[model samples]
Each structure stands twice: as C-alpha cells, then as structure tokens.
Target: MNKLMILTGEPLTRSILANFFDGISDFCVEGSFEDVPGLLSAVQNSQVDVLFADAEYAMQGNFLPLINPYGAKRPLIVLLARDGQAAAKSYEMQNVIDYVIKPSTPERLFLSLQKIRMQLSLINSYEAVGAPHSPRRDYVFIKVNKKMVKLSLDEILYVESVKDYIKIVTEKKSFLVYNTLTNFTASLPEGRFARIHRSYTVSVDKIDAIEGNTVEIMTTRLPFSRKYIAENQLKVFK
Candidate 1:
C-alpha cells in the first residue's frame, strides 16, 4: 500500500482529501495537517509516498523543497486547485507532482491518481531495464516534400495543425507533413511528446516557458487544449 500525507490550510480541504482516498485499498492517508511545520515533521519521520497539498501553501513558501529533496526519492506532491488555469500556472513555477482542481469529482481524482501511478510504474520499469549506452529512442524521421530530414528527438519545438495537415516545428525550421496531429503523434515517441492542444504535439524538452494554457516553444507560443490538459501533469518534462 502507498502511504500518503496531505497538507492543506482549510479544514474542508483536508476532509475532502481524506474522503477522496478513503476507499482506495492500496492507498493510505497517514495523516493530514493544516500547517507546514507539522507536515514537515510527519514527512521527516514517516514513510510517506505522496503529498496532496494546496497551492496556497506552496505559494506561501512552505516546506515544499523538503518534499522533493535532492530531486530524487521525492514524494509525489499533488497540488489542489479550483481550476486548470491556476493549477497550470502554479505547476509552471512550482515542483508539485500534479494538480487536482477543486470541485473535482471523484472520477477526476481517481483518473489523476491512476495517471500518477502509471508514471511511477513506467519510471520503475525504465530503471530496471538499465540505462542504455545508446541514445534515447525518442525521435523519428519523416519524408517531407521528397526530402528526408533527420530531426533530433529533443529539438522538436512544437506542432501546429493546418486544416488537414500538421506542421512540425523544430529548433531550426518548420516542416509541413501530410498527416493528422493524432496520426503523427502515434509515430513519435510516447512520454517525450505530449498532445497539449488538439492541433499540437509538443516536445516536452523544448518548452521554454508556460503561461496559463499557453506554452512558449522558443519564440512560438502554442495553446494547450482542455482535452490534453491531463498530459500536462505527466512529468514528461524535467
């Protein structure tokens, strides 16, 4: 079972988190605290696997770093908010594992948890597979206008949708390809590329900045669609 510790300032928020995970047999809410001091103490002494926290506390400058010390072995810290806009903004600047918007239904919460679980599993699998000496298999080549181009996996900036076609933007130039964003997405490596918008598939590494639902790739800014918002929390980047 995974042990969890929740930190929220509001009494209602703490209660909601407790009830949300009450039925999950594999998860255990070890404790809930309204202040950062207690939360830090609990985390230091207990085997907490995750921390569901409020963005306000994170913004207030609490023990956020302790929850993710050394950048490894850090407990997944999920931030709770009322909407995706605030969550996206907070996540862009903070190191929270994920975000849960308020008025969040049980189904939404479960799906978020499931996504985190899957990410954790994938990380474990990768570690077990041993680090490959060769380059990461996260890029693909495409034929454009009778020309064969070798695109670097990490150099992809963003993808744009143009009616029936999709344009792939890299560090150097943009390539117009004869494929749907969805179909082209299937050809690229998973985890590394995310469908942030219906018309876009962005390389997680090329993101230079994020504001609201818009992600800045180099000089190009792209919109993040609601359909692919969940992908934003997958930890594909950094």
Candidate 2:
C-alpha cells in the first residue's frame, strides 16, 4: 500500500482529499496537514509515497519547501492548483509527477495516481537489470488491445501512461497498449527515445525546447526527474 501525505492550508480541501482516498483501496491517508508543520515527522512515521499539496498555499506561505530533504528517496509530489496552466511553468518541479487542477474529480486524480504507481514500478524494474533492446530502425511492433501492430518509430511523437496501459502518441494517431512503460519501452530504440519523466517518454527528434526541468515536445510540456538528469541528458532545440 502507498502511504499518502497531504499538505494543504484549506481545511475543507484537505478533508475532501482525505475522505476521497479513505473510500479507495490500497492507499491510506497517512496524514493531512494544515501546513508543513509536521511534514518530516509524518514522512518519518509513515514513509509517504506521494504528496498532494496546494500551490497557492505554498507560494504565499512558508509551507514545506517542495522536496523532502531528509528522505532517502524524495516522495513524489502532485501539486493541486486552480490555474494549472499558469502553475505548470511556475512549478516546473522535478519531483512533482503532475499538477491536478482544483475541483478535480476522483477519476482524474486516480488516473494520475495510476501513472505515478506505474512510473515507480518502471524505474524499479529497470534499476537492477539491463534492457535487452538495442536501437533498431525501420519498424517496431507494439501491443494494441489483443492485437499486435507495427508502428513506425518516426511517426511516434511521445508516449504517456494511462492506468496500467501506455499510450503511444503519434503525429496523426494514438494507440493504447495494455502494458507498462517498462514493457512498452522495449518496442522503442533507446538511442532515439528519451524518458523525459516517469509518466512520459518522448522521441528525441520530436523535442521542441528544454527549459529547466521541462521539455516541450510537439506542443506538449513534459518533465524529467532529477535522478535521471544527472546520468542522461536529452537533446533539446533550445
């Protein structure tokens, strides 16, 4: 089970988030704070997996400074904000998986949570073993529903996770494979594809810009985490 810790100043918002997860399975609300007053303590006690915080609260007040300093592995952050579009560029948080706009439904929040769990799984899956695939050209085969199809690597702009499945997004089309990013990546040539973030992987040829931790690929902004950046750097237009 993933331990969830929430940091929000709004009591009503905090209660809503806490109550929502209580009804869900495999997750327990470890702690919900009015501020970052006991952030480290809660993390110490429960070993929080993901953090849901309010951007508006953090910006004005001295809430917890985004990342968990004492943690061996920093908890993944999911920023909750009203103006997510505006906050996207503002936050640019490497640890933050995604930003959920305010008044978001459980469906939307769970979708992001699924991606987060898959992401953590992917990283752990690859950490111990070497990937068997080498950079291949021409065509690649991917799982689509119960059928298998060949997709040209050049046509693919990026890939994102949706629940237990992965979405292969191409220039003109998109397809979902009932697979994890760890498995879905086996179809791609490592030399050409970059794991921009946990929930995202993009073709290097498709990247438009790299500003701080964010990568703009084909009109979409994706993030790369701090851990990966130190070892591998992606090619960016500017």
Candidate 3:
C-alpha cells in the first residue's frame, strides 16, 4: 500500500481527500495536517510515497523547500490551486515530479496516484530483472556564488564556453559556472545532447532551424565546427 500525506489548510478539502481514498485497498492516508511545520517534520520522519499540498498554504508562508534541494530527488505530487500561478512557478523551479490544479475531482486524483504507482512498479521490476540503472542526465548540482542549485536537464537549451567558464542557457535564465565546456559536455547524456562546436553543446530538440554551418536555437545562431558539421548534416538529411 502507498502511504499518502496531505497538507492542506481547508478542513473540507482534507475530509474530501480522506473519503476519496477510503475505499482504495492499496492506499493508506498516513497523515493529514493543517500545520506546515508539523507536516515537514512528519514527511522527513515517515516513509511517505506521495504528498498532496495546498498552494494557498505557501501564500500564507508555508513552503515545501525540500522538493528541489541541492541534489535531492523530487517527490510524487504537488497539488496546487489553479489560481495559484506564483506557487506553481515556485514548484516548477524546484522540479517537482507532478503538479495538479485544484479543485480536482476524485477521478483525476486517482489517475495521478495510479501513474505514480505504475512508475514505481516499473522501476522495481527493472531492479528485479538486474537492469542497470544509468544515472539521470538531468540530475546535476551547480554551485553559484556560494549557493547550490539543481537544474533539470530539460530546462537547458545550450551550453557555451567562455574562457575558463561555461555559460548554461535555459529557457527562463542563464548562469555561468566555473567549468570548461568539455567538463560540462561529459555530464550530458549521449545522443540527445551533442557538441557541435568547440564552444557550443546544444540540445537537439532545441534546434529551431539549421542554416549552412549554423544551427538556430531561438534567436541565437550557434555555429557547428568542422568535426560535427558532417554528423549534423547526416542528421538533417535523415
């Protein structure tokens, strides 16, 4: 049975969640709380499989900071209100597993829960079958001016060499890290990400258009070096 933890300020919402899962034999409501501090403590101590937290709770100064800690893994669910775009943005920056907008029906909630269970089951099956667990390409921790940050792989658009440093460009922002382009290239997964230039490594999916030796990514024109031009040409041909 999967243990679920609910952290919502509304009493009616809490009751509804409990009742919704009451008949599910494989799900157990381990804890439900209106207190954010108390809920955080409980989550840290308990073997929680999923968390359903209200977005309004964060507006009132109750925040879930652990979901995207340094190099920590993301939690299962983060339930937010449809009107709470600010809270949703915060959760997205942290790279939470999934976020659902309320007032969600029991059917929607059930489907989300089922998806989590299916994913977990698949992971377990892979382990049992002796399938090697390759390290996640997106799971990289970066230190910036004494603060550590975790960046999602999908968020990265491209990386460019700037002398001794590498500039990481994302959809929303960019950051300069004290590392060479080669070092950063090694961290990316093969095939999906490729070094097209001496200074540039771009996500293949982020390519807007390819013109001659330059690949267009959004507004930027990234040049492909002689070594990678042939390979990328073959890709374009296919």
Candidate 4:
C-alpha cells in the first residue's frame, strides 16, 4: 500500500480527505495538516508516497522553499485548488502528479489515484531494472472491468477521444476506457502511433490512404487536423 498525506490549511477539508481515504485499500493516510511546518515535519519523519496539498499554499507560501530541500526524498504532490490558476505553476515541480479542483469527489480522486499508481509503478520498475522497460511483445495490458486485459498492438486501428474517456477501436469491436487521449497515447508504442488531431490518434502502419485532411483506415475515413500537418512526417502525406 502507498502511504498518503494531506496538507491543507482548512481543518474541515483535511478531515474530509482523511475520512474519504479511510476505505481505500491501496492508500493509507499517514497524516493531515492545516499548516506547512507540521506537514514538512511529518514528511521528514515518515515515509510518504503521495501528498495531496492545497495548490495556493504550495505555490504562494514558504511551503515549497522548505520542502524542496528534501530533493529526492520529497513525496509526490497532488495539488488541490479552487480553479486551474495554479495548475501550470504547480506542475513545474517535478514531484507533482495531479492538480485537482476543490470540492473533490470520489470519482475525481480515483482518477488522481490512478495517475499516482502509474507514476509509482514506473519509478519502481526503473529502479529495479536500472532502465526503462521496452515492450518485448506486441501486446499491452489494459485495465477493463477491474481486470487487466492483454491487447495486441496490431489490433488497434485508431483511438477516439470522448470527453473524459477514450474509445480504442479494433477490427471486431471497441473498448471504452476511462482515460484521457494524452495519457492513452503515451501508453501505446511511441513511433507506431501518430496523433493526427486533438481528439484522434491513428496507427501509422494501418493507414490505407490520406486524401486532403482525411486518413483512411480500412473502409473508415477519419479527419486529421491541419495543426498536426507539420508534425506528421509520414511519406503517405507526400
């Protein structure tokens, strides 16, 4: 289980977060603080894997200056703010994983927890192997219905983004995954996929034709955004 800490200046907010995490099996709340010094001290004394902090306090206060001195020992941060105003600035910190808006719900927090798990998994894998693991096989494991589903890379034709989810299209059917287009694309083999639009990513080798702004895969033609024209170096565009 990953140890988590909550650092917000409001006692009510801290209590709510701590109580919400009580039932979660994968994470344990080490402590919750209404001040930076208390949080910093706890961080120094405990083994914390994740820290959910108020975004304003993290950015505008003396919190970062004191905490950053810990360097590699600093726990991963998830900033909580009323709006996205502090998101860009807070993300500059390497340890920050997610920035959530206030009045956080279980669903939103679940997504943030998923990101934290993925980051921790990557870090652990790299530390154990001394390098990033490259895919040796053509298949990748995707989470579906609370289980891991092994999917072949070649089985993917294209991916469509729908709001907070992505649809992975294959020959027979498509799977709806609770993931952003950006995160889903990063999980796939890098060179094999081309992001042709903000909402669409296609398999490079599966391209049947490209006429104007449309890319044809099998009998289906998908529109490509001109914004990616310069970024696309596929000879098919020639």
Estimate every model's Cα lDDT from 0 to 1. Answer: 0.70, 0.67, 0.68, 0.76
Residue-level lDDT of model 1, residues 1-238, one tens digit each, is 8888888778888887799889888889999998888888887778677788787776554365455443233366688887777665456322255788775678878887996687567546655674564346544545465333556677777778886557778767788754456666666666777888777888887778878888887778888776777756674444
Residue 153, candidate 3: C-alpha displacement in angstroms: 10
Question: Which has the higher lDDT value, candidate number 1 or candidate number 2?
Answer: 1
Query: Which prediction has the highest lDDT against the true structure?
Result: 4
Model 3 worst lDDT window (10 residues): 65-74
Candidate 2, number of clashes: 0
Q: lDDT of candidate 1?
A: 0.70
Candidate 4 lands at a TM-score of 0.51
**Candidate 4: lDDT over CA atoms?**
0.76
Error of 1 at 127 (Å): 3.9
Model 1 TM-score (2 dp): 0.51
How displaced is residue 12 in candidate 4, in Å? 2.9
For every model in order, what is the number of clashing pairs? Answer: 1, 0, 0, 0
| Candidate 4 local Cα displacement, residue 32, angstroms | 0.2
Residue pairs with colliding backbones in model 4 are none
Question: After superposition, which runs of candidate 4 have C-alpha atoms over 4 Å from their true positions?
Answer: 68-70, 131-238
Q: Candidate 1, 93: how far from true, in Å? A: 5.0
lDDT digits (tens) for residues 1-238 of candidate 3: 7788788877877887888888888889989998787787777777666677776664443254442232232345556566656555434322234456667678877777777677557546644654355544444666465334767788889999987568899989998865557656765676667789999999887888988788899999988788987765554444
- Model 3 residue runs over 4 Å out of place are 58-63, 67-70, 82-88, 95-97, 122-238
TM-scores, one per candidate:
0.51, 0.48, 0.49, 0.51
